[model samples]
Target: MTVLDQRALNRATLARQMLLDRADLPVADAVAHLCGLQAQEPQEPYVGLWSRLRAFDPAVLSDLLVRRRLVRTHLMRRTVHLLAADDVLAWRTRHDAMLRQRVLGVYRGEFDGVDLDELAAAAREVLADGEPRTNAEIVSVLAARWPDPDRRALGEIVLALVPTVQAPPRGLWRTTAGVRTVALARWLGSDADPAGPDGDDPPGRALVRRYLAAFGPAASADLRAWCGLAGLPAAVAAVRDELVAFRDARGRTLLDLPGAPRPDPDTPAPIRFLPAFDNAVLGYHDRSRIIDDAHRNLSVAGARFVLVDGRVAATWTVDEGVVVVTPLRAFTRAERTAAAEEGAALASFLSEGENHRVRVAAG
Candidate 1:
């Protein structure tokens, strides 16, 4: 098998992630293409889409939320993600067990005697009216039935047990609002699709394909890392015939869709700004393809990064409308110029073309 070195994997990642060249796709399609944007931070998806899409209008994303075309929900890894409504409805059921287990992992002792099925039925009853409710609001009502578990734990398990979407304007572009959730089925006007019989897991198989399309040439471990589902080995096995294989430098088996873009290792990677918790860095078990080992913790620490030559080279933030870039390492004069130029573009995007100032801190 061909051994894909780090640079080879880096370029491939860049291509698959649409960071090598911005895509002209529409906002919802791009969201679907990327699976979804990690959207715990409400305004960050706008910046993420801005970096990937050409002429991305934040209003379109907000409009999608209002129109029920896009939704914010707990899906992969049980984190808040901005997902296409159709994808969420189709994939939400598949994640039900994992979501329950993850919340339990965090609050197991708190839920010792609580019957989760009963809790779910009750929670559904609470949400059945179709009115959006904040977590605290939902939990206060449920606190009467299950006063044993910590309120936080009780609320989290309720959300996991009952598939729910965080309602807008929680995720609306440039809008600051508290999280209010409604039942996923009620919000989308359809129940989440049930798993296929005999444990076929067609959605799991579809996820395997989709992950490779966007983040692939990856290992089974990487796929698991991306989706947080432990049972996809069966899914991978079912689809094994559909994929091509390669080996990473570490000798781990890598899989990819045959026709997916794997650009040349030396492809010129422009400086691109990424949002906190962006999956391009967090989607894999091994992130060395796009981030250095020394800086690996930054990916999970919610630091927005600047990609210099397709690798994380700096962390960025905005202060008083200025895009502030603090280099993680020394940059060449040209790299600095490119980063500033791109940072300016991002600032302008954030400010709606009012401010484009960028400060690249000394080396």
Candidate 2:
């Protein structure tokens, strides 16, 4: 077995994530290639795409949302994601069980005596008219039938039980709006693909390939962490013949598509700004490839990061329209210059070319 050291993995991650060199792919193609962008914060995917796409236009993304070409939906670990509409429809059925289990895990006692199928049917009844509803409105309508669970939990559980998506304007670029959900079928004008017949999991197998294409040289554990589905070990086993394998420094086996780009370990990785909850850092169970273990918690802490030499080296935020970067460690003079240049570009993008002020705090 080949042993892939951290630097090799880091370069591979940067290439696969389109951070080594900004890609010229169209926004929809970029979104599909990356699988999806973590979009819990709504406007974050625009930033994530900006960092990866060479000539990204945020309005194109917003337009795609309004055109039903993209959707904001709960998938991949049951967190909100900005996904291609076709991808979401093809993938949602596979994630159904995990979504249900995760929500139930949080509100199990509240649903003790409730029949989940009945709950799903009732929720579907409420959505059958193709009306969009806020979580509160949905919960309020169901309150008379099932009032024990926390209203928030009931709202969450219903969304999981029924295939739903956050409607447009919620995820529109630079637009702020409350979440309003409509049935996935109604929203997309197409139904989610049903699961494969017994003894087969087609979507699971497809997810394995798609995940590796974007985040591979990864372990089974990493795949599970990325998708939050425990049933994929079989999916992995089924696809073993299609993959090549390597061992990480920790002696864990990493599987990847044979033709996927694994750039030279010393490739020069430019400074890139990543949005909060960006999967480039969060997609791996072991994120040492792109982040230090000491800073691992920052990946889940919702901190936007600055990648210096393909590794997380600073946290960033905007203040008064200025891009403010606080170094996590000392930077070389060149690193500082590069960070400033990129930060200025990010500021311009965020403010529609109005504000490009950037402040890199003292190391």
Q: What's the C-alpha lDDT at position 257 in model 2?
A: 100
Itemize residue pairs with steric clashes in candidate 1.
Answer: none
Tens digits of per-residue lDDT, candidate 1, 130-234, equal 899999999999999888899999889988999899988888878889989899889989999997743688898899999999998999999989999987888
lDDT of 2 by residue, 1-363 (tens): 999999999999899999999999999999999999999999999999999998899999999989989889999989999999989988999889899999989887888889989999999988988888888888888989998888988998998899998997798877889999899998888889998853587888999999999998899999999989988877888899999999999999999999999999988999999999999999999999999989999889999999999999999999999999999999999999999999999999999999889999999
Q: Which runs of model 1 end up more than 4 angstroms from their true locations?
A: none
Clashes of 1: 0
Local distance difference test values of all predictions, in order: 0.93, 0.92
RMSD of each: 0.8, 0.9
Model 2 root mean square deviation, Cα atoms: 0.9
Model 1 residue 81 lDDT score: 94
TM-score of each: 0.99, 0.99
